[model samples]
Target: MAGNKSFFETLVMEEGGNVTFGDGSKRNVVGKGTISVPELPSLSNALFVDGLKANLISISHLSDEGYSVLFSKDYCSILKPDGQTLLKGMRSSDNCYCLEASIVSNHVSMDEQIELWHERLGHMNFRDLRTLGKFNCVRGLPKLGKKANGICGPCQQGKQTKSMHKKGKYLTTKEPLELLHMDLMGPMQTESLGGKRYIFVCVDDFSRFTWTYFLREKSETFDKFKMLCNKIKNEMNSNIKSIKRIRSDHGREFENATFETFCNGLGISHEFSAPRTPQQNGVVERKNMVLQEMARVMLLNNNVPRNLWAKAINTACYIGNRVFLRPSTRNTSYELWKGKRPNVSYFHTFGSKCYILNDRDQLGKFDAKSDEGIFIGYALNSRAYRVFNLKTLSVMESSNVVFDDTRLKSNDHEEEVIFSDVSPLEEVVVSPNVGTSNVNNDDTQPIDRVPLLDSKEPAPWVRKLHDKEDIIGEVNESVKTRRQLANLISYTCYTSQIEPKNVEEALNDEFLVLAIQEELNQFERNEVWTLVPRPKTTNVIGTKWIFRNKSDEDGNIVRNKARLVAQRVLSN
Candidate 1:
């Protein structure tokens, strides 16, 4: 009889007496069951004895089951009725025959193993699953036999999406701006920090360079498109090229009369994709999907708030332009569009903890020189990184910043960590007459600003550095200001008119402090709570302060407001 209930495959509980051993020791029998072991016939009527150490088998019981047991000096053997040996056991030091067998659950069938791996891999296709196993592509994966015979419910649901049509094998456009693909993404559930809910995306078919604009509403789509068109025309006129044709889905934003009139006035052709067929304008649609997915992952991985999605998407596009390669070519989107390589020396990990110099605010001798912030994106108008300052609860662009990207904040050590590509002693190159900041500012500068010393008479700084700088090491890129003025106008709402994240931040603002005082006075007047002696066994109900900016119908903040709220504490 087996001692552990886990060894039984089938069990039945019954009122039973104690089982006596040879030493007159007894264990209470709790249940009777069938035990299934690997490479052995199922043992029936095995008693589960509580407080028993080792399992016991009776030779008389085996004989009754048509098996004969013979004990030798050193071993014991069991034989079937036909005289074939069933099992053999070795004699232990205690002179007891011990049988060795493994539990059935410990071994897995080939099909079960394959199915387990399939589920672990997020329900991958069986063909690829077997390929991975066959080639040992993944460690710890055994040789897969075949797909599981049973259908997976999740696979049927998730993989049922219809595939898109095959992409064309040839390049359709020969130059940048020859053909452009445009698409609009949102009305997202969560509005961005700047109250943007939609992303207007544009792509050049040839270079695959993508541009994205955050919009507050659908009506802003046309304005952004017109601005992009005007900017592109001005920039491409010298190359004898302009936006020749554009493709987009038949959304009301793109198919409107005003949009058509604008395109017709510029002698540009506007083509509409078939209804519900995103593949026709797949260039920008795919880019939109990629950008959104990238943004989602970055936000989730870094635990950044969802309201910062626009910053993540914009940074994704900014990086993709310089990093993603053009199909069937060794050139990048930046190179194909600008006729020169793009430099990404200044790129930092998004959502990285940073310190922005507190030059904008007045500081005393012992005051902090910098404010803690999170690196968001790059600035369009200047050589700077966009940071979301924790103290102000606002986003701003600043050239003077220090990034702490590598180490965890919970770590005790405070040694500064810098990017691997730049060296500590590397000199910062400055313009002809401009004074230099540190390496941080120089790296953040646009690549096109590589100083040129062509006058035969070198500048004083140039003479200090071998009379010339290595211009070939730098890339000449033309920056496109998609909505520079519009961004500046929008940025003020987020920076200057800030909404406090907590009571601590609210205390620092004079307006918010007044708002908080007014809220407390209103609460007292309404008799919200009464002072009482604390009960030793009772827990206190905590409180929280919520701060908001009261805005007018014209979308301008008119007043700072604060409210006291009882914190919700959930109990088990």
Candidate 2:
């Protein structure tokens, strides 16, 4: 269990050794757990005593397993009866059996640990990543310092952009569906689960909830948008209803007369960013950036094939929605969006080892009942998990599976008290940056798609980072126009709250953890996907989270919101 870093024993030894302490106290080892690592596939037993200072191996146990111990003048050797030595032990200068083990002490400073984690997590924003160290999510992670310093190369390479104007502020709203931030990402290096090359992302400004859809072409955006609008309108069903407004880039797919007409017909307002100024729609653009970054790491680190990129992004967005803290609110996105809390107890490390039970396969008397696989993410539509089966080389979801998260699972099942009580739902005012805003600027012309050159594919994010400053990052003075700013005081105040960085921190609060799980159960209830044998020559789409926090009419925090989506990949 991660709760216990080191193991010892006090279970009353059956037939072990006894060493007298200076104070004449003695300890007997009785309880044991398997001690295994990649280097030692099967180290039989480890004790559970809390007070023991040193680790000891039983000589008799080794002998019983067909080994002989030989004593030399200066050293000792454990060997097979035929004289083949397995391990060599040295006599310490203190005349003790210094079991020839190389003990390396690891001491890491908080800053250094932060830097290492920055690399491990693919150089995510330092401010958001600081809590990973604080939560002790990974073993050997030291207590983190409050601040992080130093620039990373990959971040400088992939995310660099000219600084933006400091004056742009947030817009506020009263509830979910009041406003939606929409954006498109496309024309990629690879195809997705459905052969899609584009992704449509929709974010709710009030709850900070986001939803994503994969498309084969830009024309498909409107249809997807309408579908979500209908679903949300029906779900929210109340005296106060419908999407009040939508904010997006000045792309033709959105700003054209037809799109405007559609939105207006539904009592929804349409707004566009200034020409070449995506920061005006920074909320969803940033959402896209986060989704892409997370997908990149999950795929690259896990050795998942590029074809699974869609699954990775989808899964990232799903996880992000449940755990990521929205700066402007005290509650997470899931809590605010849904009145009840979410439960997230089943979340496991992406890319870790897992075993899927082969219940579908009729096993012979000697057949292996489980297939070894890599942990990917949660199943889209079920209470099972999605895994990449090494044998089938396909992704599948199943409930009858086991996880080898030795470093994460706690041995004790007792309730951990992170919070004393669950808080009641509070009103949440959606930020204009996230969802709803009244835009009157109709003068900007629609943007036409520039045909891709046959000789060049889209520039990698690392390359685009340098050229996209005009559209993203810093606001330039040269491009400044006579644009009026609204009363941005509420938006300014919203950015000052203590938002959570990851699920681990949220898990520290027991109420939030249960809330996370309940949120996941919704997907299962919705029948998002099914667990089945991997079909030959077919791609199983991956899934993930996009999280947020909703605020009340007065801009006080509400709850966290999570969205599970597909990492839509491009088909070959």
Candidate 3:
């Protein structure tokens, strides 16, 4: 045996040459040589042999060489050789080969297999697809053959409706009092200071300037309009032109003869909106909103009392005129009207606790230097400021004032001590240790030892009553008989129960009836008894008189009370 074998051979080789049998399972060969082997077809070629059995079931080859004979199977064979069957199974169509002579007779290629893979995988562009063989997971995926555009569902849902009024159509006049819009608002539950329950507001259509006046009754609308018309006319020095059109709701106040006549007299055209239509006078109506909002904010910010909201509202309007910009103009109403920048240096904090100099009081060594007050508002007609004095219980005007801006909170003032000019000795003193002292005692009596007179006993006459008896009798005779008799009898019998005949008579009896009369005059001067008659439909109670006597320490009568009482009536 040779050490090397031919390319087409099934020779077994070892380190040395040795001959191996056809069945080499039990033999070992060490040499290589060219062996007699049948030629096999190339993988690229097909083969056809003459005189071969037809309907061959399979073909096989052995070894790594170009060819080696192996068992073949016929269609009707009982069993095929295991080695031959295995070799035939391993020979795939893609890997098979045949010689050039066989290729010239018959040929085949793997074009079908290559096409099958392309069909199953789909021809996706390698660059488009990720390197890992999957679609790229990006934020925005491009549509096939289209440019990428990100989707935003939220943006679509959040789209808003178009504005009603576009740019450039809003009111844009620059001068104050040139164009005015007027509207009346409310039959409010609360009546303002001055007992006003309704508000009539006028807004300058150009500058967005606002002026509000309170009315106790809506009938005052014409008066307010007239006042506004005169003010604007005098201040602007312009005639009541077409710009002086007065816009208002179809209220009785706006429709009444007084309003129409006033408008006609001033040559001002009246523009009345339809009934229940507020938007027709939209300018002033909208201004009312602006004013009310500002008023509310000011009241809340300064912690001002709600009852003083009228002042707060007025102050809000003043500040709004100075600060708020016109919708169409960069300048404010104050700047437009005054033709100069407004000075805000005089603007003090509203509702701040302040001390107003009491100009009404003549300064005394013991008098307070200033009166406690709350800064309410600025005076519109004057340069002074308005303050609500807690001590005086009145609204007062003062230009001279000191304010504590940090103290905007209310109900924090110290309680005031009210003093009277009367001496402390004048006050009635009740002492438990000492028995009630007599109001009347002889001046010559010893201070400690004299016995005080009983209150029930009548003291000695301080003056001669007999001297006046003749004059009293003459005056008593001039009156009607029944009245004179009633007076004389009532006086004599009820002297202890009521007041004496007169102050002089009471004084003659050592009584201070003059002092009591002086106090009574004070109550009358204060109008404590000016009662207006209630309406018939009103469920008013009937009043009655109750008499009482005021007494001193020793129980001596000092004054008398004639009070009225009422009896409740059933409500409807």
Better of 2 and 3 by TM-score: 2
Cα RMSD to the true fold for all candidates: 28.0, 24.7, 44.0
Q: Please give the lDDT score for candidate 2.
A: 0.56
For all candidates in order, the CA lDDT equals: 0.65, 0.56, 0.46
lDDT of 1 by residue, 1-572 (tens): 87777666568997578889888988888898776543344568888898888877778778777888888998888887888877778899998898744323333354566665554332445665565555433334555554435565434533444675554467998988889999999899975545578889999999998888888789989999988887776767756676889999999999999999998998899999999898788889878866776666555444454556777677777766765666767666777877766654455666766777777878688776777766677776677777767666556878787775542322222233211221122122211121112322211211110010011111121121222355443345643243542343333322226787887776666446556656765776578888889999877778888888766565756566788887887221
In terms of TM-score, how similar is model 1 to the real structure? 0.47
How many Å off is the CA of 376 in candidate 1? 0.8
With candidate 3 superimposed using the best TM-score fit, by how many Å does residue 400's alpha carbon deviate from the native?
1.2
True-vs-predicted CA distance for residue 556, candidate 2, Å: 60
RMSD of 2: 24.7
Candidate 2 per-residue lDDT over residues 1-572, each given as its tens digit: 11132321112234445445578997654445643221111235555443566565667766775778888889988776677765678888767675554321111244455555554343456665544333323233333333334565445545556784342244487777777999999877866534567889999888787787877789989998888877676666755566788999888888887797897788788888899998888889888987887777655443344546676676666656655555555444666776643343455545656677776778699777677666666655455666666555456767766765422222222332222222232322211111111112111111111100011111112221234546755545454221211112222222223345665565443224434554665656568677789999897777655456666665655455555566666333
Candidate 3 per-residue C-alpha lDDT over 1-572 given as tens digits, one digit per residue, 9 for 90 to 100: 22222221233333432333345622333433333211122221112222222212223322332343443232211122332321222232445332223321221222222222111112112222121112212212211211112211211222223554333447645445456788777876644434456778888777676778877678888788777767666766764343556677777888888777776876767777888888778778767765665555545444333444566567667766655555555665666655665444455555655677766878788666677666676654555666666554456766777765552122222233221111111221211121111111101100000000011212222221235655544644543344443344323322334454434444332113323433444567567666787788676655533445666564545455444345445322
- Candidate 1 residue spans exceeding 4 A from truth: 1-169, 407-572
Query: Residue 214's C-alpha lDDT in candidate 1?
Result: 80
TM-score on alpha carbons, each prediction: 0.47, 0.47, 0.42
Identify the leading candidate in terms of lDDT: 1
